[model samples]
Target chain A: MRFINVIKVALRALRRSAMRSILTALGIIIGVAAVIAMVSIGNGAKSQVEASIASLGQNIISVYPGSATTGGMHGGWGSASSLTVDEALTIRREISGIVAVSPEMRDRQQVLANGLNWNSSVNGEDVTYLDIRLWTIAEGEMFTEGDVNSAAKVCVIGQTVVAKLFPDGDPVGRSLRIRNLPFKIVGVLKAKGFNYFGSDQDDVVIIPYTSHLKRIARRPNLNSIIIQAESPDQMTRIQQDVTDFLQQRRNGRDPDFTVRNQQELAEAATATTKTMTVLLGAIAGVSLIVGGIGIMNIMLVSVTERTREIGIRLAVGAHGRDVLTQFLVEAIILSVMGGTLGILLGVGSSQLISRLNGWPVLVSTSAIVGAVAFSAAIGVFFGFYPARKAAQLDPIEALRYE
Target chain B: MSHVVQLEDIHKTYESGEVPVLAVRGVTLTITGGEFVAIMGASGSGKSTLMNLLGCLDRPTRGRYLLGGTDVSNLDRNELADLRNQKLGFIFQGFNLLSRTTALENVELPMLYGRRHFSTREIRERARQSLDIVGLSNRADHFPSQLSGGQQQRVAIARALINEPQILLADEPTGNLDSKTSVEIMGVFQKLNAQGITIVMVTHELDIAHYCKRNLIMRDGRLVSDTPVVDRLVATEQMQRIVTAETDAKLIA
Candidate 1:
């Protein structure tokens, strides 16, 4: 028989049992939809983590002090301050890939402004701190190098500190008392909502490190050093160079500092999300196989039910291949149609979820196409056995079947 | 007349289970074009097996069977299907018209698988003409379920004739119809045979067999008798007589 006629006949046969065909295709629809939704969710989570990391700073590397051991009682990292201001300046001048470096000292202090006292962490660093941390001034200006040279008591307040200390007016150029000493607020920092650890990022105050060392928290050793690479691609090399330089400066006695970069954080976050996506995709793939089995079951029953019809077709001059093509086409049509509907459902549901829950979802075109092709392949794989069984039927026996 | 079908020492055995039963035991038969012949036997006498072999639906276990001067006893499944399509038409006892299909489409089915490529318009026109030949042109759009038994049988005949085969093979063609409807069906067969189409029919009813020009009797899987009908019954005349008798009885009541 001609190919067109075979398709027409297959369509007619499917139409004869439209309900069964739709039911058989439902399994595939759910499977494909689940896969698409889960994958999009995974992609969304990965991008969300990347965006958070980007907000923290670009190509940032932080150096923490080494651990301390007194009388065999070992202290964890950052227990003793081994880094100093001179070392931070040396890294800035000597490292070829280093763009900016700042010595950091931290302390919690109570500040009184407009008769409201608020307790917030006071971060002290040089003017390079703004560049290394990618923090911008929202109101006035950052504390300049001249302020650090003379140990001037000028500060930059973050959004949370301003909200608590000066609720109705701008805090720039306003006088605030910290540790019974009067300080002038030079700027208000821009808002950065939260970090990956759910801590408020804009809840601190920044001051000149020279002022911090002379008056606020008289310390000889620095807490940590923050460095920024010239570009994102140079981060790993810069980190290695910094590590080697620190080891040499410390006489290579098990290096007193540890270097960490944003790339490692991003990679760790991405790996977790990717693992979840693959796990969800694998679970959905099982449903697709189950859907294929459903198709096989329905096709087998169809072949048995239409045995006499097949016999009549054979008696009238239809080849076995013709019968095989007819059933195979039916199976393919069912699965392809289901796959198309599944894509629509998946996209719509993903959008709905993102909108309702305020989560990110990315629906890639390649994933949609791959899902459709996979379903079509599944149709062929599962449809083969039933079609072959129908084709191999003996016409005489089939015709004689009641 | 040219010989359209020739069988020599044909045998068929059925190995349904452990015991082997011979359905047709070494029977030789020859049928010529334009001849209307009927094979009559009781059930289990191998008349159906003979019809199957003649239709090329089943191959004979022994001997040669030639169709239209071509040896076809050993043809493969596909070749046999082609031969059946090109040279033979079959009418089953059950009026085996596809239930959900209209009369016209049912008649168009055979040509869909025919060797010659026919356009849709030509197929439709030829199917209409075949239905007209069986006096079913008015019911072309009706499904088999909507038609009476006799009408359904007529549609089956139209389907059988749509391919324009040289020979028509019928297995108990009127077995499901009333006596009057059976006579009407027989009249249609006779009309086709009179138009120079050879027909081989299987019927156990003697009255139905007498409508043909010749009769072959089978006993124990063998052709025990072959003779020309001494008093052939014309189906049209028999149908007219039945109608008149029913009318006369109704008037007497």
Candidate 2:
């Protein structure tokens, strides 16, 4: 007759068979736990990918040499030639949306500081490279445009080289030898960690492009160019401007180079990770459905076992709605209890995994709420038939049941 | 006298695998308020089926059955349940007290099912008073299994009385008890009947039937005899000896 009374009756019935109640709860527990854990793992991976894409700077654009479409050298190298330093300067002057531009020359060499030498690459660029790649000088001054023009021997080193070569001293204003040529360390770059490909961004060295082309690479051309736009909203216009400018600079030869914007790469990464999360969550949901079916089966058995009890209540005064309400409440209580316990278990296990294995794990609020609601809905959906059967039982036959 | 229950040409037929088995054939009966009656018949003679019809648990295949002057033959399931709660109390042979509940709570169950509103204290107090009427107030906290067969039947009787129903229908109430316990239970029934509560009991025991003022015997789904018990025994006077023994058992427990 009253809602609380229905809960009391359902609880009393569940208490009658302790072992069966616990066994039924076990299925829901595993189901909810799997959902929470798997969802957290998926969210964790997605968040990590987002962080990685963010680290690359959403306003930055990378231009790589595009392959030749027609008769590449008539079978020459089949690849586009390196962009020149003069082309990079022309882009900074002509492009309407360009915020910064840095032409780069890269070569492998052993860096010498004090008595320790590390085999790492030398990246030659102007002061604009730091802004284009979203980097900052942590120590002294970065090599200026004057250094690039005069071919000065000043350089800016990454945090990794500073750690290895100058373990106990300040690396700024110190002399380091690259390719057996002496150079002054003008500044230390800030740490930017690793990328998706596990490449350490802090392990390279930066120098003036003039110095790199004249002394290190001994080449007259540039390798690539990094560009930063005013904002992410301006990326498309900036890409068009760069493509048009490069084609014109190459004498309308359809300059063999490709422009990649950060927004597109981030979107691709997001799509990949979101798909992975759903795939994992769906697999875990199968176990939840099985758990719901298990609850339904046990509820059916309970109705059968307590047939006489149902009869007695019906004989006394209970309506079919009353009988059905009692059983449905019992099912919900069991699942809710299981859901709460499963959340605790899932969260604790995720934390444990992160701490023990150093794996990325983030528990989002949506995952918790989603799992709990799903479990409760499962109880109602699966428990309905058994409750209906109990409600519809014939009181006369039930009273006579042994 | 105002009749508490009436059956007019009632008929019941059971369909078992395409064959109709007649359970009751055109039985007409009336029970007045405060009358104590017994239906005596051999097994399968339709006495229990008639009891079910009176209790509103089942409907007759034909004819009208009236409880408290209201025709209930065509009532819906919920309305029939309401009629049972308000007008009838049932006691079964197996002492159908819910085994897990305490005697007090078991008595309060029927009252709880009805739409009437009562505070918890009021419900408990009413249940306690019903238990006292059955002389089981001291054992209110005891479970069904903790009591003897006769005591459990008394609890059932208490449950039946809790709703203050106009009629008590007991189907073979003492069928599981020994001779002494059966007579003691008969004493309780006589006392209740004397208090102006109408009762209809089904029993095969001739001696048990003698405790009631009126007796009807059925054979082959039809009433063969209706007569008055001219020399009904004073069951309470005979019950004193057994009550004394039961007192000793309660003390031991």
Query: Cα lDDT of model 1 overall?
Result: 0.84
TM-scores of all predicted structures: 0.85, 0.85
lDDT per residue (tens digit) for residues A110-146 in model 2: 9897999998879888778877666788999888888
For model 1, residues B3-33, the per-residue Cα lDDT tens digits are 9999999999988779998999999999999
Worst 10 residues of 2 chain B by lDDT: B236-245
Give model 1's docking category: medium
Candidate 1, pairs of clashing residues: none
